[model samples]
Target: MSRSAGRSARSEDSAPSDPDARSNGPRIGSDISSNFPDGGQASAGGASLDRAGAKDAPAATIASDSRSNPRNSDPRDILLDALRAALDAVGGYRSVHRRLMQEASIEGPCAAFAVGKASAFMMAGALDALGDRIEKGLVITRHGYAAEVIEPGWPVEVVESSHPLPDASSIEAGRALIDFLRRLPPRTTLLAMISGGASALVERLAAGFGAEDLARVNRYLLGSGYPIGTINRVRKRISLIKAGRLANFIASQEVLNLLISDVPGDDPKVIGSGLLIPHTAADIDTGEIDLPPWLTTMARSAPDLPPAKTMDSIRSEIIARPADARAAAAACLRKAGFDIIEHPEILQGDAVEAGSRIGRMIALAAPATVHLWVGETTVRLPPHPGRGGRCQSLALAAAREIAGKTGAYLLAAGTDGSDGPGEVAGALVDAGSIDRGQSAAPGSCPDRSLRAADAGTWLEACGDLVRTGPTGTNVMDLIIALRARSPASTERSFHAG
Candidate 1:
């Protein structure tokens, strides 16, 4: 059979990245080598190991007697390096694509629509694996990420749009995508990549709805401190493209969807607001919950529809999730000779409360023990809130707990390379974090900034903001806590093990 005839592809694209595709890590198989477009010549550079930070030599621990590098082996630096490794392990586009190619045999021309924060890398990987067989494609991503993953002269139509909230551009992109889906030649297979931010990056509103409606709802949700599931459920109710509605337009055409799950449980029906999968009846039954008046009104007024009928034609796989990131990070931590304390419970609810709880946990741990937590946190916004996101808020709260404590530090950040309204992805808070905030604002307590939603301001002043501009993926937030270990503590841990 010819290369493009019988196969299909689709991925839930929103969560985060993928790991190395070769042996010694995770490998699909060698069959993909033969499927490469252009007779195996298309470089799968986008999915390579170098992108995962493996190429950078690991930072060496400072010797106790050395005066040249007196800064000692910072636990914060070690943890951050491990965090980067974790992101890189899963954040590559090439890795996911290569995995799919190894599992499926492509026989005919294919079209793809990749949407979310990770869209560009996902598209790059798809193109590399399938070669020019990807006849037509559309990429919708947040600003600043497309340029890095999309090679010059690449054929896909690309759109950069707003995120965390839908805008007019999001509606435009949605309409364009519907048109693109409709225009695909008969019998053409589709590969749809769905990732986080998709609900905001692309949308086709239901009747009587517009961008303003979505914007208002999203704003309310953002400020409401609702769980992601609740927020996305509302989104699915209002969107013509979400909750598997997008898949309805495909008719009988086969679809293969690969997903990166940012939502807890990695449910394909929830990622990207289930752009390609429909909700079940149980999904529609959101039990007694307090929703804003506007949302309640909308929910009651919005027509209830059955889940999309296209679930049968499309096959879905979760390529990456928080667990994958945690595992990667844990591996790095072990290599660094630290005792890792992994809390399996996902962090949730108020950011500040969560941070304080975690801070207390760290303060009680033995020195040299690293604590890690993964999951998204919600923040209830006060009126006219200041410039900061949940990560900043959490960092500031932790700062209050660790103040005056010796050798304790924490990092709270979004894996997507941004936190709140600022460029900072998150913050690293130490015992000095509180002092820094105080020194920056002499009349105020550090908690004041947290209360005002201006944690970013304080974090910036303290030189604790972590900025890495769009990591090309989105999972959730990663929190790492490190307690500096003394020689006695290290020996104890070794003995206990």
Candidate 2:
């Protein structure tokens, strides 16, 4: 088949059968739905424009209610609920609002630009804190983030864009951001609210490069099993706004960069591609980053790399991190009487290997023990791999390790609420998951699915997948490991939710 014909065929085959599937691009059926319900207006402090057009709308208010709080005593329910609280505590709008309110006010009118999974909430917090002091702002977030209408007098403009990969919407968002920044005066303060998905949500193409090229590069890097820092360094080298380029453009303006970190080190330079933090000469000289030949060439040849900024106008702080999330989980589990086992190092490397290793550790641990870990995992996808994400695959691999063992359970999920291309967040797996997989298809095994990177298919058949839609936050993945009561013990094991 011709290349174009092959591409068309693949696209057709991967089209979602579900009516509610997110249409960011053609991809196979996955458990997680990216088409989340729109978060209603985060703040009613100012007037605004509808995303579909520049028409007037009523100002909106941000509700403080959260979806987590469970009434059941189920261990899974408690664990998941605790996670929600953790996410809320770290990435919640109230925290950002409080922080902004406490900080010394900007001298003149300020402009805020928020980008990522938590963009709406973060932007809302800025508005509530800054009030009429913020003359105008822009928010570039994932699809479905801007579903509600804003009040007529609100000044911020919200744009929904593709995430984890750049699409047409991403291109438009990038153009909008660049245009907005270009119009600001040198003395105007710029407040950038950044989180995990900003790397893909906002972009400005280098000269002679198109969105397709950028998308292709991102896909290759995502599936390469390389760490995010490596992927972002290459990304920074190829764009006009990344690696502190945006800060360089503001020239002499005070820039306050607030972040809810989703990366391991919580380094602002890697977060949101370091939009407001310029890389120093020493940083460029530090330890090498290995990438594919094509990516290296593109990184080297890309036009308009951000020149190192010497001004001291930029300041940054991490509002949240994985440690904070893990701490919350530990506190919650301890309250429930489970002895928590915390791993010091952030989990890393391939999904299957990591999951298998962690699963074995949990299985052999003492009864009533809870193991918690946080970090991102990578999967090397096979050609046309079936629906599944790194977290799902990790859970499946862990399932295989704990097969036939009673009371062994694992909950693996992304805090952002969507994992990979699926509508579901991740999965909750136990010994029964293996039993269901075996009964669903004779001779079908988690090993086979793991090999194919098709864990979601097998997991769905086992009824082990977990879904929470979009939680309006992203801080990497969280894993909960628990062992059942000893055979002679009287205590009850954690029941799945």
Candidate 3:
């Protein structure tokens, strides 16, 4: 259809650094701290509090909050805000533990751990209840986000790894997970915080597959623009620990899984790659797994290894999910009392198409309640020699659709703050978006040029971008509210879990 999107980048040592990175001196850095109003350094939830200053503005400023980002930011920002909100909503693991013990009936001594940008927050919520009683904890996150936790005496093990693509850190984390379980006694409680990025964080290559080769395959598939399900099929086939394999090691441990879903369906077998879901008889029979080609040859040619065993002794639950985050988002908006039209998770797919679809929908709204919910759309871009992410590209493209429409409040963001490679989580778009977008992208004429995944370029032109820095999470994406002449406009929007 679209001339083949450009070749996707790999995780090689020389792979272009984060696309959102700015060259301060000779080194590149992804620092969005200065991008937000008030320099973006307020208290945890203070980011949204700044809305008061822009209140008097016409057609909310380009840098509007998320109703505006906090799920619908962009895949990157949605991922980021979801982490922060989920973490903040449940509080940290210690606080969550206290609340659960006092509020809901927590089943047992198990703890929870997540692997993603949201790993910290997911872990934070998990530790809320299990922090003190749990024997040990393990959290693996993308490199930059490993600094959020400061738990004492809980003996939580933290590992910083790569994402979308695996690296040595992935190998280390996976092996460490296996080694850590070895030290635990039978029947010990395990609180696993497995989020979207776990596929990379916990990746242990299927024997014979090198991390480098796997990275190559990932690069190829992403550029191929295949659905995530198809990509994961190949990923699961090539990796030893993905799918349900990670859960096999803790067969002897009691597991309480706290997951933050990133995949479209949030299937346990796919979310964070079903690390805790046992490949039960049912799963094994119907999972219909897929693996990489070279990997299959390796699997067949390699020496015999014991088949992975799913532990029936452990228990797991999807404590936090994309749907949960969507609900939380819906609640926030409904509380604000705008005519709510909840779309069923329009958070996934090509950034440009998703944005255009929502933009067109917002443009056509006839002053009614329209809450659209979509999830897990992807952006397949060309190999342009430029810098940007899928969310930014979506916002840029959406800007064109809503070029002349007034009174529209549209937002798109990733649950994870880091979209492909930028810092301003997601963005806000409306009628004047093109003007702002053109201004934002001073170098590139903000003309109607889809230009394929050049979100970085488009976003830079429009000041209506929403940047929460890093909310430290991943849920997929959130596209909350877009105004279309509603008779009554409410000031608040919500999605409470």
Cα lDDT computed for each candidate against the true fold: 0.69, 0.68, 0.52
Per-model TM against the reference: 0.79, 0.77, 0.73
Greater-TM-score candidate between 1 and 3? 1
Write the residue-wise lDDT of candidate 3 on 307-331 in tens digits. 5434554456565556665665555
User: lDDT, candidate 1, residue 30?
Assistant: 10
RMSD of 2: 11.6
Relative to the unseen true structure, what is the C-alpha lDDT of residue 106 in candidate 1, on a scale of 0 to 100?
A: 57
In model 3, the runs with Cα more than 4 Å from the true position are: 1-113, 151-154, 206-209, 216-227, 251-253, 280-293, 301-310, 345-348, 368-370, 439-444, 447-449, 484-497
Backbone clashes for every candidate come to 25, 21, 93
lDDT of candidate 1 over 402-475, digit per residue (tens)? 88888888988787767888677788888887787778878776777877888888888877777655565678
Residue 17, candidate 1: how far off, in angstroms?
A: 17
Better of 2 and 3 by TM-score: 2
**Order of models, best TM-score first:** 1, 2, 3
